[model samples]
Target: MNSPDSAAATATAFDKARTGLWVSLQKHLTTVYEAETAFAQAIAFAEAFPFAASSASPEQLDLYWQRRRALRDLFTDETNQLDTLNKAIRTKGYADAEKKQLYLLLLGYMDIAASIFERLHTEVPKPLPKDDELEETSARFERVRKFARLNVKGIFGLLATAAQ
Candidate 1:
């Protein structure tokens, strides 16, 4: 019963919605990638700090602590951003075909993130030497890595179902 012009307009609107979804997904993926990089840097710093033959000066210790804090903050911010993006997508609706495509793309990214996190968690070093500082750092890294893996899996499952 819709006129040709009206149908065309509807199609255009759907296209725009899909485009918006893609943009949002891309932004979230970028944030995730950045968070991953920050986490890797934090791990490297932590690993190097403990192995240095010379005693770490107070300044060096402070710098390592600062890096750890920064990485945590980055992860928090990225998580918040992902939540916002999910709300936006829900509000926008996903009944249209174009929107379904966007949902699939998001699912793909979520899968990738989950896989990366799992690999990192399994590969990361554990059981630090008797040093308390090294033990604490290793524990923190393990905790975050585990959290990331679990988070990614949950997100991926949700997105996959939503896309379907």
Candidate 2:
């Protein structure tokens, strides 16, 4: 028979994970917002001047190079934070089922971000993303953020019952 001590410990572990995940979501969401804004602004700036894009090769343009560097830097930072968050949960002694669920949720969030960034990085220089596409990507990221915030709590509560 499972002991109440284990249940209590599980609850405590979940409480800590939930709190840390909340913080991570907040920070990651802020970075996502900033990166989206910065990338759009960079594209707009390049478009406004017109002549800045005057090159036989889009890669030769200064603004193009600048955006590439920016995306690379942002992606590097995000990867590091993602690694840290994964490590935190693994060492926390959560049940395997809960751990897998959390991992999948985190990956979903990361995929939304990576999609936006990758689309911008690839399409921004020459073709420029369609307004509809940009809107769709923004909407997708919003959905991911909202879902992550709401679902993580329920997951924690659900796992708490398993403790019993």
Candidate 3:
């Protein structure tokens, strides 16, 4: 029932979609890491030198707040990009079942990444430091580890499916 041309067209579409998804994901990840590093530095700075009016300048404290705001803004921008990518994928028509499944899995993964960013935004110390900061940090690392494992498995699955 399937013509060679149609099959080729489908393959092209699938490849294009996959590339877009992965590129978007990579950008999101880079932003996440940058934000995380800035966050950790801010926290360390705060903990090391308590912001006493006598000890620290108003300008120094202002710089810290500025960095925090910038990180929050970065997350917001990333969330918007992810939402746009999600919409594009959802609107696209996937004719092949295997390709569709792969697309759907990727869409789900993007959603997870967005959720992680949302959590990161909320947890970003608007005020800084709670008793549970350490616990939260540990949990975050675990989540990243699990996500990394999923990424590896997903890539291998895609390769195997393509090989067939």
Candidate 4:
């Protein structure tokens, strides 16, 4: 566990780009979490109201493909950002607990985001979830998501407050 002072020191020691990247990572993480929540809600909505057609119309299917493509693009972009972050971490000489923050960002958020892209990309004609499943998914991810949000917020605050 990193102390607040260490966090402050770490943030202050980095150049503006490094600090800004850290904040961007936190914001991206929050977006990832919110995206997951929205996805679950969409599933729940779909479960309640089944699609009118047994199969999607060409336009509808095209829309799905477009969304999947967009998600893939976003995931690719995030991965590039993560590569930048990893290099920055290594360059900063952060060891021990300080490095753990990267796991929270790179794995907790980015990995999950990537998995979402994979799942959507691999969806067969209608890979629908069971009606009851989304509730469980929401419950399970919410706790971890909240924890991540809090820690990321704290870290960002510490970083932002640090003197340049």
Give the lDDT of residue 20 in candidate 4. Answer: 65
Write candidate 3's Cα lDDT for 87-156 as tens digits: 4554667643544555555555555555554444354433455536434543543454344334445766
Q: lDDT of all predictions, in order shown?
A: 0.52, 0.61, 0.56, 0.53
By lDDT, the better pick of 2 and 3 is: 2
- Candidate 2 lDDT, 49-74, residue by residue in tens: 23334543554455555764576566
Query: Model 3, residue 113: what's the lDDT?
Result: 50
CA error at residue 80 for candidate 2, angstroms: 1.9
TM-score of each: 0.48, 0.58, 0.55, 0.49
Predicted structure 1, TM vs. truth: 0.48
Best by TM-score: 2
Residue 18 shift from truth in candidate 1, angstroms: 2.4
- lDDT by residue for model 1 (1-164), tens: 97999878877877887677678667767766776665555455344323442344566545544554554454445445544544455466445344445545555655655544443323233432243543444454445434434444456666887899
lDDT value for model 2:
0.61
